[model samples]
Target: MKLYPIEAGNFKLDGGAMFGVVPKSIWNRTNPADANNMIDLTARCLLIENGDRLILIDTGMGTKQSEKFFSYYYQWGDHSLDRSLKKYGFHRDDITDVFMTHLHFDHCGGSVQWNKDRTGYEPAFKNAIFWTNEAHWEWATKPNEREKASFLTENLLPMKESGQLRFITRNENNFIEKSELDFGILFVDGHTDKQMLPHITYQNKTLVFVADLLPTAGHIPLPYVMGYDTRPLLTLSEKAQFLETAVKNDYYLFMEHDAHNQICTLQTTEKGVRLKEIHTFDHLFD
Candidate 1:
């Protein structure tokens, strides 16, 4: 099996929103903010190639929103989903599965795109089965007031409409173990309902797609949770337990939002789990 880091694009968000209760003096040291107080964030996705299946985790924010809508996020960078796929000698249609961690606009917006005529939207990965759990699917479809803005219809409805949506439920043992992929799913609810993280075992190493649970190495400290999380206290507990498990297993965290740091290892310190080392994906995998 081979894994590739796909760069969908970069955007900016309010640093205060991203850091939640953490003071600017602390988070700013790691993720410095711009003059507008927005921090740089990347919609970095992951691609896995195994046998006949090519799976893409998360699609980043697509380019189908109105200019006024996009004006809010302040997106920048030339990196694009299409361009990233082409970098790996593949195309959008070549993906066999799209495993969405959640249905937030930044995470799954690229799953659907505007059709040729712009009359309607369609599944961006023409031949891929879009994967999400039943709980998350329902939560995103009928979003609450706080999360409604993040779960846009244009980013989700088209997959089901295209007859390519599939639910990744637990097996008899209450674990997601797909024999095709060299990984298992770890479901957490702190960030959103049933957010799935892929715990992949490759080349005698366990590399986890951290997703929003641990957006960057800076988030390693227990209290550095995102304000966007629906339940902050629950996030604290989840992070504590997950960090302990990550340390026990000596896992490599594949960060999705950290623009400068791609992968990091954890070490148990007096202050709890902290980043031990940082390495590029190619530096470690290649």
Candidate 2:
């Protein structure tokens, strides 16, 4: 199997919001913030090639939102979803499966696009079966006030409308459970409800698609949680448990929102879990 680090684009978010309850004096050391307290983050998605399936993990924020909506995030960079796929000798239609970690705009917005005439929305990858949990699909479709802003209807509904939406409902422990193609999972609910973290076994190594659970290296600590999460206290418990597991397993965390580092492994220190190594995707196997 081959894996590709697809760059979608870069955007900024309030550092304080990203690092909830954590003091700026601590998080700012690694994730430096601007005068407005926003920090640049990368919308780094992953693509996997196994057997006849060409699967994409998540698409970054698409370019369909209005300028006023996008101005809030301060979008920047040229790495688009289509451009990244073309670089890998493929196109959007070539994707056989799209495994969205959740329905957040930054993670799933690129899955749908506005039609040419602006008449309606359409699945970005028309031929692919978009994968999301049934519970998550419902939660996003009728999102709460706190999350409604992040779950735009245009970014969703298109997959179902196009008859390409499917849910992975094999079992509850989809996290520790092994997927059909020998892939593993780590289901985390701290960041959101049931965010599946795919653990791909490659060349005697494990590459974990860490969604918002541990967004960036700076979020390695148990306390560095995001304010966007509905359950912050639960987040702390979940993070502590996973950090130990990631350290014991020497798992390579594929960060979705870190701008500088692509992947890293954790080491169990006397204080707690700290970053052991920061390396690129190819470097891990090279």
Candidate 3:
């Protein structure tokens, strides 16, 4: 199996929102904020070439939204999904499976795009089966008030409408030994509902695509949870359990939201689990 780091795009989010109740004095040291209090973030998607199935995890926020809608996020950089795919000699049509960690716009937005006629939206990857669990599919479709803004209809619906949507059979435990996509899936609910984190064994090491469960290396601490999370207390518990397991197994966490750091590992420090090391995708994978 071969792994490629796909740079979907970069944008900035409010540091306060990203770090939750954690005071700026603390988080600012690591994720320094801009004059407007926005912190740098990236939609770092992952592409796995396993045999004939080229699976893509998360598709970043697409370019279909209006300028006014995108101005809120303050997007930056020229890195795009097509450019990144071409870097690996691939294209969106080449993807066979699109495994979404969640239905948040930033994660799954790129799955659908405006059709050529501009009449309506359609599945971006014409050949890919968009993947999400039945539970999340329901939750996102009928989103609560707090998360309604993040779950845009334009970013969803089209996949199901296109008849390319499918769900993974979920297990009762927080971790699935092996998902239909041929990798372990760690299901956590603190962020939204049933966010699936992929635990892939590649090149003799375990690399976990830590979605919002651990957005950045600065979020390694137990108390550092995102304000967007519906259940912060549950997040604390989930992070505690995951961090302990990650440390024990020496897993490489593939961070999806951190613009500066791509992959990180944890260590058992006096202050609990802390960042042990940081690695760029090429530095470690290549």
lDDT on C-alpha atoms for all candidate structures:
0.90, 0.88, 0.96
lDDT of 3 by residue, 139-202 (tens): 9999999999999999988999999999999877878988999999999999999999999999
Off by over 4 Å in 3: none
Per-residue lDDT of model 1, residues 106-182, tens digit only:
99999999999999999999999999988899999999999999999989889999999998866544246653345
Give one digit per residue, the lDDT tens place, for model 2 in 148-247. Answer: 8888888888889899999876575546567644577667776777778889988888888888998999999888999999888988998888888888
TM-score, every prediction: 0.97, 0.97, 0.99
TM-score, structure 3 vs. true: 0.99
Q: Among all windows of ten consecutive residues in candidate 3, which has the lowest summed lDDT?
A: 170-179
The candidate that wins on TM-score is: 3
Off by over 4 Å in 2: 174-176, 180-182
Model 2, global lDDT:
0.88
Determine which window of 10 residues in candidate 2 has minimal summed lDDT. Answer: 172-181
Candidate 1: minimum summed lDDT over ten consecutive residues — where?
Answer: 172-181
